[model samples]
Target: MSHPWFARPRPRVLAHRGLLPADADGIAENSFAAVAAAHAAGAAYVESDCHLTSDGEVVLFHDADLSRVTGDPRPVAEVPLVELERLMGARGGLITLRQALEAFPDLRFNLDVKAQAAAVPVGRIVARHAERVLLASFSDARRRTALDAAERFGRGIRPATSAGTATIGRTLSALAVRSMPLVRRALAGVDALQVPERQGRVRVVTPRLIEAAHACGVEVHVWTVNDAPHMTRLLDLGVDGIVTDRADVALRLVAERR
Candidate 1:
């Protein structure tokens, strides 16, 4: 059975780190404002990263440190929730994992577990809203840990998850050899394969990869594509989703195609 996260129509526009409004200057990615902007732009899916604060609270943040976003050289894990909230408040708006899920009841989320400490908490938090969330991470171990935690902590329901880096590598290797069995094995249990169209010079999301993923009942989503032409090409190539910083543009493109 398809998870509810995939119930929405294909060619999904996953707002990368939420969507920063064109006129909303200083609003950081993953902030409340960015998420709200995505919602306002008619994005059904919002892709954001997760990290654990010093007080063990789960927050929506991208980088390991606050240097780029806040000009503070402190690590996110070393800052308390109150302090983090204060900093984010001035930049845009602060939002906890629980708060975001509660606030956006109708929007689906693609959450990347960035911190090791946040894996279990993310699982626990999304357990209640399992149908509407898809968990992802570069580390397969961290991703699996969260999946297990979700099952252990909440209602015995495991939320949808995407392939991790290792899994993607194995799947690509299988595809290189035209091994459908190997490809299916590599994609087993994952609902989506979120990847860059290329890793350096090597092309990753070819027609074969998309076909193999579909064979395994997995959806292919290309990441960080912001331009309209690239978005149109990927959608033409039958990609299931596009993760983009410009949700407004992507949404318009998808609508035109429909």
Candidate 2:
């Protein structure tokens, strides 16, 4: 028999753009096909980035503004969802928050909040299925709004948070090396701390760091890894979960171990 946490299959893979054809239309990152492919590929769960369009509609996207992914310039807050939908290429459709919920009813998702405006819609949508999802945001304020609204709506996800990626600034106070007061305090408020395997010029998720997070009853999940050795290493270090862009490779790794 396996221990409780150990029961989780090894190497959880979150498909990068839902195992897309790599050049297919609507199979690019953050598109419906990308999300759908993630679930169909046997991902334990899926992850997505979200930003609200000008019409207060939350569209699936990883960036604050749409210039890089979108061919032309358009501020996410300045354009409505309908307009965004019309301008989409392979990877650029506007997926409403409600559509994602109703579409993937049973799958667990890590919805990364990229805009403050998204908080209210996120909270309202998750309130519809609070037990089945996790809400996260780079903005603590946004996360807090979601949490607060969940309560107002009597959604059962008061403990869920919009956890940020941990960085050195995340782990250290302005004053000195010995002072991790700010980082610890930030972690204290979050149910989990999502950090990149590499954040900025530094590498986090050391053995000691993982131990420390677990000591605080917080799960540590590292993101966007595409290498087998690194995935294996994170598992060896006993990370609570691993997020990856190459869900195909990650899923295969998980099945072999299971």
Candidate 3:
């Protein structure tokens, strides 16, 4: 299902949070409806963050605590997956890593591992879909551990360096950055470099950045893009992938340009 060379959809669209609230669907983030919308919208890949529950089930959730989404101020890990499911009844339903895999059946997934404790269990969950799942994290160290476990479990891991609203890749390389060595090592273990689009008032995702990451055999995926002009700019600059809220817009933009 996860074909690395599946013609690489033109400026591949990764529907963010399943195209939630942004569209007519009132489906909240981290809910099943959101995922469905993302896939239905023709997103080739769907990205979501996952956290562990008390019963050790790897449940799909974006935030670490229930305070924001659930309106309860409890840590998700402290609640058993069952209880969480009970709270998130049939409206959305709690989905385990297994459920996600079985339900989607080949959708390429990028999972953000929220905690180090999640490493082993998350690794085990994604392993079943090795050919299709890619694990990403802010913590290179945590990503390394997850990748190791994923390898043992048979899933391929992808190294990531999020630009966090800061445009990255405008610079040719991280050669001058303090964490270059660590990033290089992390890049060696994975296939892609995930980053943001803005950096200190200077757009970082320039051709040089794409060239640099590609030179190291790392594909670049830019995230959270919500506008068309910016999308066009990145594509012209040769970005490998674009994660956005408007998959429809991305698809339309590419089609119009073509």
Candidate 4:
């Protein structure tokens, strides 16, 4: 059976780190304001990263450290939840995984577990909202840990998930040799492949990859694409979703194409 997360129409636009306004505002990516903006822009899916704070709270943040976003050089894990909230208060509202899920009841989330410490907690939290959540991570182990935690805590209800880097590599290798069985094996248990259109130089999302993913009942979602032309090109290639910083534009493009 298809997960409820995939019940929505295809060619979905996932708001990358939520939506940032064009004006030079203090709003930060992954902040509450950013998420609200994305929701206001009509994005059904919001993509964000998760990290554990010093106080063991799961926060929606991208980088491991606060240097880029807050000018604080300390790592997120080194700061307590209260301090982190204070620091983010001036920039934008700091949002926790629970708060986001509760605030945005209608919004589906694509959460990337960036820290090992957050895996178990994130899984436990999302298990209650599994039907509307999709978990992802670069580390297969971390991703699996979260999924397992979700099942353990949520009484066997696991959220949808995407392929990790190692899985993607194996699937690519299988595709290179035209091994459909190997491809299916690599994609087993994953609902989607959220990957870059290109990794350094090699193109990752090709027609063949898309075809193979669809054949195995997996969806292809390219990440961080912001331009309209590239979005159009990927849509033409039959990608199931586009993760973009410009959700407003992507939503418009998808509407126009439809």
Candidate 5:
């Protein structure tokens, strides 16, 4: 059986940083308003980032430093949550992971662990609500460490996870050689393979790769897709999920098809 995280509708619309489009006037990514916007637009899942504040609070802010988002040259871990909140107040208010879970009870979340300090805290927090959470990271070690922490919490069921960069590389390598055994081994603990439609010059999502993943009961999710034509192309390519910055548009397009 597929994990509960995959039990939702296929061609899942995972709102990247909560549907904050590049031209969005006021809302900020990973903020409470962003999440609310995604939910209000009929998105069932929201993809977000998590980092730890200096005061040790786990909040949803993407960058390691606040320079781009807040124009403060300090790292996120050096800023207190109160200061973080104040900075985001005008944009869309800082939102903690816990507050998001509580505020949007019906929505599922795809959480990318962005900081080392946030791994354990994220695991512990998501443990109580594992059914709707998918934990991920760019680092395989960090991903496993967070999973291990969740296991330590005695939740009985670990949250679903996507393959990290290392695992994705290994899987792609195995698939290129047509080594099904190696592919299975690489995807052992992962529930999904979240990847870009293309990485530089190499096309990442091919029919062969998608077939191989589905053969092993793993779903393929492509990320950061924004355009409708690309979204339609990917859906035609048989991907199971689309992580996008334009969730509002994606939702409408998907619904129109249905």
Candidate 6:
């Protein structure tokens, strides 16, 4: 049960999209430069999103369309990798999944399968580097599809995975009833549960939930956290990892805790 993802220190600091507001010379998010910055900051984990281009190339990008990042109205799946690189070159250059794995050999990546088309390719790539990758998505089906692809291509070892939304719901329901058997079964094969502290008006990540996950030997990592005090609070609550846009501060805080 000793997975490679847990080899690092507890209360992991996973850089969200490789840290934001990067150097003026680098792209702000999900760019190679940003990834380098996170590595330089001494972060062991980085969280990013994946999408497939029109030509079937997998790139590390968030959002279905380019409007937010590039101010272009084109969907990622509609653009070819060559043109997408050209479009993103000045920003920080487009980084493919393979490039990321090759470029950061020592870094562990937590990748979200952003597009349905990206699932299999992401799996094929991660399958080659199973020990250092964690595959995830909002859709359980998409996550499973990627795992299946990895199994087919990975020579049989599946990468670490966090629970998707549906799996989370099932696990939470099992927890509500205090059913250990159900909790164990619901969390089967999941290495972790990465979720926000809250959804809409409902609060997640309560003490009981954390305890339940810990009992199953599964980690609880909360995402998109940016403030130091809030990070401290979550850590105090026994979260195994923190996924944040401000990894610089989180790193310092973790050191302070030590």
User: Which candidate comes out best when scored by lDDT?
Assistant: 4
- Candidate 6 deviation (Cα RMSD): 1.3
How far in Å is the alpha carbon of 235 misplaced in model 6?
A: 0.3
Instruction: Write one digit per residue (lDDT tens) for candidate 5, span 1-258.
Output: 677877877889999999775566877899898999899888999999999999988999899999999889999999999999999999988999999999999999999999988999999888888888999999988888888887788468888999999999999999989999999999998899999988999999999989999988889999889999999999999999999999989999999988
Give lDDT per model, in order.
Answer: 0.94, 0.66, 0.69, 0.95, 0.91, 0.91
Per-candidate TM-score against the hidden true structure: 0.99, 0.83, 0.83, 0.98, 0.97, 0.97
Model 4 lDDT per residue over 1-258, tens place: 888999989899999999997972999999999999999989999999999999999999999999999999999999999999999998778999999999999999999999999999999999899999999999999999999998888855689999999999999999999999999999999999999999999999999999999999999999989999999999998999999999999999999988
lDDT for model 3 comes to 0.69
Return the TM-score for candidate 1, rounded to 2 decimals.
0.99
Error of 6 at 163 (Å): 0.3
Comparing 3 and 4 by TM-score, which wins?
A: 4
lDDT of 6 by residue, 62-100 (tens): 989998988899999999999989888887778999999
Tens-digit per-residue lDDT, 46-131, candidate 2: 77877777777777787777787776676788887777787674463556667777888766667777777787777776675666
Q: What is the Å distance of residue 99 in model 3 from its true position?
A: 1.1
C-alpha displacement of 40 in model 3, angstroms?
A: 1.0
Q: Report the CA-based lDDT of candidate 1 relative to the real structure.
A: 0.94
Q: Where is the poorest 10-residue window by lDDT in model 4?
A: 149-158
lDDT of 3 at 198: 68
Candidate 1 per-residue C-alpha lDDT over 59-119 given as tens digits, one digit per residue, 9 for 90 to 100: 9999999999999999999999999999998778888999999999999999999999999
Candidate 2: TM-score? 0.83
Off by over 4 Å in 1: none
